[model samples]
Target chain A: MKKIIFGIAFIIFFSFLIVSAINMRTFGEPTYSEMDDYFIENAQSETGANNVVTSVVFDYRGFDTLGEATVLFTAVVGVVALFRGVKK
Target chain B: MIGNLPYVAVVIFVGLGIYTLMFKKNLIKIAIGVVLIENGVNLFLITLGYRKGAIAPIYTYAPSGQAMVLPTPQALTLTSIVIGIATTALILSVAMMIYKHYGTLDTDEVRRLKG
Candidate 1:
């Protein structure tokens, strides 16, 4: 039975592999990176952070981080609510 | 491409996750599958941000001529990882609750809500 699942997964992934191998961008060289170039060059000057990634996370796209925090908070709230009667 | 071995790893991870999801009977196993998929996607994002012979996005004494990897995807993946942890924890706790309420961890056994 496990073999069946494995076989199906193998075929699906193999198809995906073929599609990606044919249509994929060149390895290690990302196109459509004009935004990346701008951030790399200006992030230091704008955010005073040596790490561009950090600056982008905490500064440039702060609202997205806030949303993620909200999502985590909601999940924690739900989990706590569901398991509140565990000790009782 | 040979240089993109990380993608192969991503493919394996995703495939394993899907296989587990389809075949596993345990709720915890399903949660594990979800985590595996999340990790595979995160790896794919990091891979996309990667560039050959490039340094990380941090600069201290590094010269200007050196190529720097893309930071946006890395940042997005960071949040995703945190979110994944939260979601996994929630799923496991919910599964535990279902087990407590139903007196069994098996999904088919927990079908009735009156239990």
Candidate 2:
């Protein structure tokens, strides 16, 4: 009985997620294509990188990548610390 | 054509990874699932930059005026792969520690670290 209720709740929750994902739209004018085109055109000369995505990930949004790495590092460190000094 | 097969492979691998993560009770199995997912994502990123008839992104062999597979995704994939390796290694080490401390690999039973 409890398992049936949990399964029904899980199905409903995922159905809601599916609907929201399908319905989600860009908040503003779609600039990614235009920006991507601009980046592609000038990426080789400007960034010395042939891959536009690489330029975007490493150059245009490097700070964001750095922050992401930092967050992951901190999480790993925290997890390690939490489990430290335990008797084997 | 044939090049797109890698994309499908990535999807399948990722799906399998998620399934393993969701259903497996062993912490080591979950870590392996995470590695599988990382490899799938890396494969997807590499496939995104693939061109039908392009050579590797080596500058010395780059054709004069022909289309080439994008190199950025390769670089990004390299970074991600390294990070994935680091994560898997760390997770495996943690799992080892957990096993040493708890004498079992079942995630449900290893609840001491939880709040």
Best by lDDT: 1
Q: In model 1, how large is the Cα lDDT of residue B54?
A: 95
Q: For candidate 2, lDDT tens digit of each residue in B19-73?
A: 6776688998999899998988898777666655655544344576654555566
**DockQ agreement of candidate 2 with the native complex:** 0.13
lDDT of 2: 0.67
Candidate 2 wrong stretches, greater than 4 Å? A1-41, A48-57, A68-88, B1-4, B111-115
Output the TM-score of candidate 1.
0.87
lDDT of 2 by residue, A1-88 (tens): 8557756765575455444434433221222344444555677788897655667678876875686577568658856785778668
Q: Could you tell me which 10 consecutive residues in candidate 2 chain A have the lowest summed lDDT? A: A23-32
lDDT string, candidate 1, B1-115, tens digits: 5666678778778877877787677888899999998999899899899988999999987766889999999999999998999999899988887887787877657678663
Clashing pairs in 2: none
